[model samples]
Target: MAGPRHVRPGPMVEAWLIEAMERYNEESLERREAYAAQVHLPGAVLQDLVWWALQALPDEILVGLDVDGSQAHQPDVEAAFAGEAHRDGLFAGQGFVISEAAVVNRGDSYSVHHLPEDWTDDLFRSDRGNRGGRFTHWLHTHPNAPAVPSGADADAAQETLGVDMILGLRFSPEGPLPWFDDVDGTRRTLAAPEQPRRFGRRGPPVLGVAPSGHRIHEIQLIAFHRTGLGVNVVLVDDEGWPYGWSQD
Candidate 1:
């Protein structure tokens, strides 16, 4: 008898596979968060980062940033305020700035592959050192996808003690907008998580009418600690003015 023929997955099977993968990724995220560390980022930095990520839309890209902050059992309002007052308190407890971003060349269709080990080393060596804030975060874009961690993402994140962030981008005829989220490597809990309006879901049903008018493009942002703690993300303009929340 001939061997069984190879068959492609049908739509239903494909959907099931996608759902299964999503569930697996979510569970993996939960496991990683259980031991993740906490991080705080400025709204302005986030805004700029997302905008940059969106520019790479239809293709994924990698970004690196220097993080400045000290560990704290709880968020220190004074430290945060002091940092803001001096513009140098980012090294203070629970206060951070995601600064000095550099876009990594990942070639075309980069999403299908991981960063080369040599490239990762080079990025860190060139972008971080004793001269400035340490390379503390790895951010990437997920065009037209939810701001959720993937299995591959989880695996790569294991290589760092720093935070891993994902910027989700979905474009409308209006323009390119993106959402951001983080995956913790230390598994520590965060004190606050930003909440923002979501777009991208289908419009509400109406009798004899299409819901095109109700359709809205959305951008979502979130952050999580290794211990499954959600971190708040504040989106701001270049000058630090509030733009929106990252969670709900």
Candidate 2:
């Protein structure tokens, strides 16, 4: 019989995974019905945009959108940090871009120019430019799969995406919902207060909820790599994964 080999995971990795798993189980609960709350951002409506964007693009690719507004609104302070981990960067020629949940695009191409000028121009032009995107975050479908990020997802998220990532699960009985920030090496589950399952004319919307049970609507997850200049948005999926013409 061969002796047991030593397999060790770094302390940091172990800690992060523990944290993520704790979050996952803690937030896990019976699917319920709740109200949708809206969040206002500068470039464009991120939350609402994400819902439609995910539906349109069902495959795995980062996204970038041009959100040009006469004015930028005051960012939500608390909400900003909720899933910040999932917001990571990819090391392309340019600097880093935030990678949110996985992005799913059906058959349409969108441009991203609404991000902060410093972020888009400078970072996108940097060595890690491939990481940044004007798009919000990444999103993908599990195909009636689990709501958890897979080993491949975890790897891509850490190396490719460069930040925390969100996973969207497509359950048949329902449509699609999202889970965020398992990149710390741990699996953290995000959710709202448990409510009685309510079937509506439409399916569930991918968004965050407030303490008041209001869904943070019209919000989109954008990723920006840490640059001396500022954060830049990358043109990738909400999950911060790579994207190409041939990719999904």
Candidate 3:
């Protein structure tokens, strides 16, 4: 929706992603090792690019923000790092795109010299349930970087052919591959560093205590979404965390 806001993750969602990140890292390491062994390269020479999608708006059917009818044409990372890979002789490379679109309707059409792969379809054909209606984005891979959106990728976003996109790259197998986005389209890319992890503390449990000769206890869980700022807040006993909520 608007520009990026530094929001902390909620207890539930934070725990989810933290767990997901652990599994993700383990899987990535496994993939790297497998690829290295197959290619007879050092395990350190393969890298995985982690991608995250952003939604412009949160889904609010009750509020009547029915974000329906969207499409994602085929996106290609072929031209993304081809030249770099050829010259660099890197073992493996990765990239991904993030957007608010509902579906990756087709394959990559954005070629260096031709139109993007999925530009021909007119109706995006949303999925049947709420999953299809929620804030959605895409993730894609690339072997290297100029790392800006290509003329084609930029055009796809500017023309509203696609919602929004993020492209990522890893230089070497042993090096870190960062995610980047042209947030304001000012030639500056917003680099989303790895989100820091927080250790968890067991939440307080509900217990009955005498209050004026009556037993009372309450466990409050609150989740709030603010469209104006594209954020979601969760409160537990007055502490707050913000999520990168979207508006598109």
Highest TM-score, which number?
A: 1
* Candidate 2 C-alpha lDDT tens digits along 12-51: 2222222322233223211101101111222112233333
| lDDT agreement with native, every candidate | 0.40, 0.29, 0.22
lDDT of 3 at 198: 48
Global Cα lDDT for candidate 3: 0.22
Give candidate 1's whole-model lDDT.
0.40
- Give candidate 1's error at residue 229 in angstroms: 4.7
Across residues 124-191, which tens digit of lDDT does each residue of candidate 3 receive? 33332221322222222232232234454444332221122233222222123232223332121112
> Model 1 — which ten-residue stretch has the worst lDDT?
1-10
Regions of candidate 1 where Cα sits further than 4 Å from its true position: 1-38, 69-95, 107-113, 116-134, 173-216, 226-229, 235-248
lDDT winner between candidates 1 and 2: 1
Model 2 ranges with Cα > 4 A deviation: 1-46, 64-147, 158-164, 170-192, 196-248
lDDT (10s digit) by residue, model 1, range 1-248: 11111111111212222232233323333443232233444443444444555554445666665543332222332222222113222222234544346565333333533444444443355333211222456667665556676776665555434556666544443233332235333222111123343586443211111122212234344454333334444322232322221224
TM-score of each: 0.47, 0.30, 0.24
Question: How far out, in Å, is residue 134 in model 2?
Answer: 8.2
- Score residue 54 of candidate 3 by CA lDDT: 13
Model 1, residue 231: C-alpha shift (Å): 3.3
